[model samples]
Target chain A: MSVSTSQALDYLEQLPVQTHRKLYEQPSTVLAIFRCMLPHLAKSIVMGMLYMPTPISSPDLDAWFRPSAAKLKRSSLEILEKLHIVSQKQLDAVKHTAFTLSPGFAKSLRQALEGSGTHRSFGVPAPPTSARKVSVAELDDYARIQWESILFYMVGSTVGFHGGGGMARDIGKGTRSLLEAGDFVGKKFGGGVGITRTGFMFVLQDTNAQVWSLLIEYLKHVNQLGMSETDVLSFLFMLGSLELGQDYSTSTLSPTQLQMLIDLTAFGLVYRTSENASTFYPTRLATTLTSDSGALSATNNPHDHAPAPSGGATQKGFIIVETNYRIYAYTSSLLQIAVLSLFCKLTTRFPNLVSGKLTRASISRAVQTGISADQILSYLDSHAHPQMQKSVPFLPPTVTDQIRLWELEGERLECTDGYMLREFPSDKDYRDMVKYAEDLGVLVWKDDGERKFFVNRIEQMQEALKKQGQRRAR
Target chain B: MVKAVRGTLVKCDASIKAMLVDIDSKNNNDFIIEELDEEHMLVKETKVNALKNRLQQMMKDRLKDPTIDEDSGKE
Candidate 1:
């Protein structure tokens, strides 16, 4: 799973079981979850079990995987168990274990794969009517304009790019308040909004990730809006499954989903002729929700004229960074230029190209603004010129290393939110607990002499302690 | 041993090609997994053999009569 999908999965796993059961009732939702949310190995495991008549025995499943891959298998199974997608059973007096897909998940997934269900959850295509049909190209243009307006709204005040006018002002009130609530932007002293650190991180992300980030934030506020979270989520998943450019009827949507459609339209996930339109066309942003980020750039809307430095219909990279730290980007979008200027000492801008240099001052300023060096590096890497892509470590190793060093110069201390454990009854117990925490990958720091350790999470450690207690009792 | 290795490689290549074809049929043509070269052939051969064995086991299980005791053991 990519970072965004894992975040969504983490949120999904936290929901009550009833919500999950309800979500699994929709084949489209199940398919979208299967396609994007599960780890690659977990997907394989699920697919293997999907058509099997009986539960897969633990030993058999273990034997299918290389011994070296056991750790991956364990973690994948752990996530599956947590999501209630799979259940384990002890099959014999000797405690032979078996695993099976949860019935709801298996049935819904089968229905999705077969495309046999009467469930119109995937979406119902709008009937041809007097409503003027919107072209895919127009929808793409609409989505990009609406999306960029929101981004420009966040960035314009901070970068003093407000003179462009009207574009940023067009961002809807609901969207602006949502951005404020999420702390992506804050109201400034005298007047307008200022972009926050989170906003900087958000703007630097690829469009698909940015959209998911915003939607996930919107998901957090669903309850406050007096809507059922599951219904909204299922509708979002359904939008992901919809074929882009096809108009889907609004007739079938519940009141919550209808309200969501209005908000989604503002975010450019869906396009409608007007608020009262009976049908809406999902933009590329909506349809590609469940795909990996790599797949996103390939299917970027043909009419998405965002002057991103890479990968629209042209299939060419636009950003080139030299070993000497000079940078050039072939883009005309004010939004992209503003994003680049956030981390570069840009000196000149031409009709189609912008030139900049990555100086220590610029990088440090960006770091201080809460944009990490790694995020900057990745943004550069993802947008590196095709010529750069031919080489290993796309960005020059010197430039990448120097940027990290600059970030490190900003601070000498690192902080972690966690708990410290000390005062062990025995040295042996402390060693055991430390080793267990290390295995769990939660141990942040430990000292043998002091018999003290720190862990970022305690739930798994508590379980380990309970098992240790049981062993001691035995 | 050489023949077994060769056989496994051939089978692995065929299965992988089949899977790629399946993916392509689904319109996910962007992903193109290249065939294994001589350098990695031996490693890939073993991996494929393991997968083939698991697949055969799955097929065998599918052909067998359903076991009623399987449900009785569920927690």
Candidate 2:
């Protein structure tokens, strides 16, 4: 599971019923979660049921998923239920058990997909004409400069570079404080703000993950400040849906949202002329939040020929890695170079190129900063060049295996944080439930005589048990 | 598999209904043409009768005009 999902689910769990109701009032949030958070097949199930009048019978849904995909289907449904996006139902007349989307979620998702409702939650396009039009390049320039400033603010103080004079802008104090609170930067024993392990890990992430990581941190702080989490979350989702390069009317936003717009502007998620710009334009960073990791990977790597516009806030990768650990990055962006420098030992530099080797030293230095080898490999794989993308494996096999092997040198034990279930009434019940859990792919461990089972994801275990009982009744 | 109808909203609907409109002898001039009054909407011939007659007359007028003879001679 990705960090975003666990974090998102945790946030969802904390929401009061009323908050969920209010959040679901806007269809965009429903659509965003439906599109981005659900597994591939979960989406299929949701769409299949989105228009149907009756609850989807549990048996029918079971039949719908292929036998081989039974586990995936069960896991998917459990996630949906846990998030309160769907519910299981029993109607006495038919003696049928069915699954249905939670009413609020169903209605809002329908509105989102159909683009109906007066909510105007998708951000009303600046009423057909706004005289002050901003070009995509201007927006990218704004995003890059603003984002780089924040990064520099964090990394600069450590390297003894105080922004090197007259940059486009310096990151604001609030953002710096938030970063410190998030532990992205820490006060060292020497009393200077030093880039922490989390910061290093953050810097190496694809731009999309980086954006989410920062925003999630910001969300936590917002919650701490006695602000409404629902307002902050819904506003963030609304920002994600806004069209890049088009200004959105701020009049319809809440006070918390209005405050967020300013903070978001500082982080380069949006652009505005003044502190009180009537309308704000979301950058590509803001808009691509709901896109899948695959799309995120494509957008980040320019050499992948993903057709992302050059001047937008979309990330473009230019690095090529080989099985022999040789690396060639075809870019001159200073920020990119700085990031690469963090995890790769530089051997040469050309006018429009940089050559580096992923040596043990480089990998260990990064691992020491709390970035795992898997993170580095995944980043490399995602940003692999187009030619590399065409191959069966994105990253070179030798390099990928070696990175893991090196990390294994440091990591000897693996730990899973989850719950254990035991003390079933009978062996039959235990066996039946264990199989159900296994089918859902949530059974981490089980002991036969002990009549005990363990599941890494508890949300699914409960659903499986409920479903098993429904099945037994028949 | 169900084929999805795709396009601007108007064109999607237009593609469904426009098959009935007669274009062969109506001069193919549809510009500025309002959809024929609702009562005669279903009958192709009745809807196009006036436009068809006007088109034939215009073509004949163009052939008979003296300016047409002069333009052809120059060419």
Candidate 3:
């Protein structure tokens, strides 16, 4: 799983069980969740159990994995159990444990993999009509224009690059409010909109991650808009599963899904010909939601056949960073340029290329804006020119390290939000709990002398404590 | 050991290369499955069988007539 998928999964795992159960009813949703949300080992386990007559016994499951991978297997199963995708049944007398896939998940995933269900949740393709069919290229153009308009609106206003003459001025009212709602942008004292820290993070991300971030924001606000969250989510998943070139009909969608289509269209996720168009097309942005961000920037957009002037050899990557902190980007896209300007002191611009230098002042300015050096480095790394990709780190080590060093100069203190455990009944108890928390990968800090520790998450630690108590009692 | 798995699978069946590619595409390059031994292949085959059975069960649950057995092995 990539960062975006894990982020989505984190949101999904927080929902109520009823919502998860309802979501599992859709084959497309199940397929999308399985394809992107689960870890590699979890997917393997699910696939291994999909067609079995009997639940996989604990010993059998353990034997399937190498001994060295026992920890990974345990963690994967832990996540699977937590998500209620798989349940464990303990056999009596012999005390053997067996794992079974949740019936709803199994059925839906099976239907999805075999494409056997008539659920139409995968989306119903629009029947061919003579109503001036929109080509995929046109849809791509529409999506790019609408998406860039939103991005430029967020970036241009912050950097004081006014006179966003045409498209940026026409950003939909719904999108503006949504951005405000997500705290990606805020209204200034002078009645003008300004970008927020979250907005900076959003801008630095690749296009696919940016789209997911926006949609996830939209998902958070669905309930207040009188829309069913499950329906909206399943529809979004369906959009992710849809073929990029094909048009899906709106007739089969529920009222909630239909309402979501309007918002999604404004976000440039799905393109519709007009307000009441009968069919909608999923853009590359939408279709790549369930894919890793790395694969997304690497693959060429099939609809994009436009000639690459220079660094546009890759679909979205155009930036080339040298060890000397010199940056060259071959992109005429204003949104890309605006984002680059946030952290790079751009010196000159050609027809399809822009050259810049990463200076200490520029790095510190970006860091002050709440854009971390890591984010800037990752953005540059992901957008590195194909020629630069031939090297191991993609970006030069000196440049990446220097950016971090510059940011580090601005601050000293680091903070983490978590619980600190102290004053245990005994040192042994503290040691045990600390070790357990450490094993769970949640321990942040510990003091052996004080018999105290801190953990990033307490739920798992609480559970371990309870189990330990039970064992002690036994 | 890794090379042995790749050699065995690649030498035994040319079709497995296409199957590996399909898996790779589905995974979105998170990790590539470049090799599989006969033992692992058998394990996967059982999983495939389990999936087929589950699909049949799903057809029974959802379909009125339940005559889609021919499409079960399509994937």
Candidate 4:
């Protein structure tokens, strides 16, 4: 089956207890899972438990989380249990149940967090040599220039434009072929290959999400070719944890991973000096896979593998859509201007600035191309100037509402895929289960008179059934 | 008869025929000694007072040794 990232994550989540037991034996895997898969508060909880001397009482844990947030706490715990990362035991002659990190996870996490493991999962840095040393700035410039060229290549062909040799040739033929195969581009009805609707959406996403979206697409195709999804995923995680400036030895990687390294290098996700170079360096693009924009922009340390200079935080957002539909952007980047031009009609272009306006016609044209106003608004929101972010609402609420309204006009009735339950044994049983659904935040729609209800997620229902079983046992 | 002092109380005995001023109380400056008992006015150093001083020293010594005081209920 073709496994997307979400599919890969679901596969990881559904691993049998025995598989998790075996996987937790590897410190690298455990550490990688903890860093990437856990939520923000869950990470803090895990860290706190890492060094505790005694099994924490459930009541004590409850006190640790706010009352209103108890549902989140319980869900976090449930996921941890499913992953085999934690265990709860009843104390002798006492009603209290104590929770502790599972021994395997605990030991592995301790090793990973302390950096004491001899496994050397983190790639070894190359020996100091001036000839092959890659500065972070050079790497960032390489990544940005290459990535921008790809966007320009796809977008340029759409507008009957030419980037001459500067942009078109930088991206490899393999990537171009894959883009066409993925339907991100198509053979224009009139003439040359042109951008597709998905192509516009892809171009509009922020760099981080765009990387994820593209990599997910890549992962989906890799499975069809019979590559091991496990090897690809673990290698991607390992790449994320590697130091940005340092080169890593490729000897430890599997053949699939090694091949991936070559393909990734062309995409500017990693760098190597020569085909024979002993080491390879993951670029900032690869390392920032899991970081939010706040971490990306706030940590100004260049050595930390920030994709863009912290100073560029404000410069990235050039477009400001006012309630009156006027748009102003302060950018000279041709790639950004080209993407904006896909949905907006540009009226003026200054030396350091470009001005555009969003009109009903322009928005409707974009909508006709399958690019919703939500995607455009979110794209604008993600790249909003740091100055704009300081305001209470990043975009003018009216503008945001109008964009949603425009998108909503096309989606008069939203469709949801879920399970519906009815005909319970009794009204009391239905009432109790419905109440439980509401508590878990999974109840999408319910009809009391009809005794029918719908839920989008089902994990909580399984637990609720177990509780009912216990009540009957009693 | 003894002669009286000119300003304050006078203490006089018939056999002594001399005057002495009484300054103990301001109520009367002049007075004559009638019958005095010298034996009742004698001063003495007692052993009981020495025992009180010894008791105070013992309490101070006990306070200096905290462990001993803590165990012995000397506080």
Ranking by lDDT: 1, 3, 2, 4
Using lDDT, give the best candidate's number: 1
Preferred candidate (TM-score higher): 2 or 4: 2
Q: Write the per-residue lDDT of candidate 1 for residues A198-285, one digit (tens) a residue.
A: 9999887777778888988898999999999999999999999888778999999999999999999999899988889889999877
lDDT values for all models: 0.77, 0.68, 0.75, 0.66
Question: Among all windows of ten consecutive residues in candidate 1 chain A, which has the lowest summed lDDT?
Answer: A306-315
Instruction: Identify the superior model by TM-score, candidate 1 or candidate 4.
Output: 1
lDDT of 3 by residue, A258-323 (tens): 888888888778888789988888987788888774422444554566543222212556789988
**What tens-digit string does per-residue lDDT give for candidate 2 at A170-208?**
588889899998899999887888888889877766667
Badly placed stretches (over 4 Å) of model 4 are A1-26, A48-68, A81-104, A130-132, A162-165, A177-198, A293-299, A302-315, A320-323, A330-332, A347-354, A368-372, A381-398, A459-474, B1-75
Interface RMSD of each: 25.5, 27.4, 25.0, 64.2
Put down candidate 4 lDDT per residue, A148-265, tens digits, no spaces: 6677878878866676535555588777876887788998887678999888877766566566666766766777767766567667767777777777888888888888887787
The deviation in Å at residue A9 for candidate 4 is 5.6
Model 2 residue runs over 4 Å out of place are A1-14, A54-69, A90-96, A128-130, A156-162, A165-169, A293-334, A346-357, A381-398, A420-429, A446-453, A457-474, B1-75
Off by over 4 Å in 1: A52-63, A88-98, A128-132, A163-169, A293-316, A385-394, A422-435, A448-452, B1-75
How accurate locally is residue A407 in candidate 1, as Cα lDDT from 0 to 100? 90
Index of the highest-TM-score prediction: 3
Task: Give the Å error, residue B10, model 2.
Answer: 63
